[model samples]
Target: MPATSSTTEFSRTGNGSSSASTKDIEVQLQQLREDISALAKTVAAVGNEKATEVKGKAKRAAADATDASYQMVEAAKSQAVSLERDLERQIRANPIQSVAIAAGAGFLFALLSRR
Candidate 1:
């Protein structure tokens, strides 16, 4: 009878230890979930910050490109006007020579077309 009682006591102690271990595991799992949730939030915040930075950079780059394009167009217009003035001066200085050159070019073109 004594031995049976001791065996029963041992069994009860084992059951208690098992229950305690299971409860500890549950608590650890819950803590892990909380930690993971915090980490996810941090990651999302960082991503948002980077996205905003990238958007600003893109906007600035686009503005710079637009300004550069406008400058190029203005420069081209200025060059064209300067060239036109130079051409007009040449034509005024030598109208006869220009007419002769055009006639010669037309004759050459006619000859080439015949060939």
Candidate 2:
């Protein structure tokens, strides 16, 4: 008896399924790079917007401080004017008393000069 080896036909076509092609991997890598670039752009834009907002707020705060300073100055001027007017009114209403007070001061000065 002679032993013989036999070959079996598995398929007629050579087409087979694979995980992914090289071109598909390249496409996926390109998409990931694009997504990263887009995310970086978004973060930069948000940072710039926040900086602008802070700058505006600082400007407004400076303006408010300036306004408050002006208001305080105006109030001080008004108080000084009121004081001047009151002194003038007092002098006018008590002319005789004012003269008597001046005479007494003068007499005191003369006595001090003698000393």
Pick the TM-score winner.
1
Candidate 1 vs. true structure, TM-score: 0.83
Candidate whose lDDT is highest: 1
lDDT of 1 by residue, 1-115 (tens): 9999999999999999999999999999999999999999999999999999999999999999999999999999999999999988998999999899889999999999998
**Where is model 1 more than 4 Å wrong at Cα?**
104-115
Q: Given candidate 2, what's the lDDT at residue 109?
A: 100
Model 2 lDDT-worst window of ten: 6-15
lDDT of 2 by residue, 1-115 (tens): 1222221121212122223455677899999999999999999999999999999999999999999999999999999999999978988999999789889999999999999
* Candidate 2 Cα errors over 4 Å, as ranges: 1-29, 91-115
lDDT of every model, 2 decimals: 0.98, 0.84
Which residue pairs of candidate 1 clash?
none
* Per-candidate count of clashing residue pairs (backbone under 3 Å): 0, 0
* Residue 88 in candidate 1, Cα distance off native in Å: 1.3
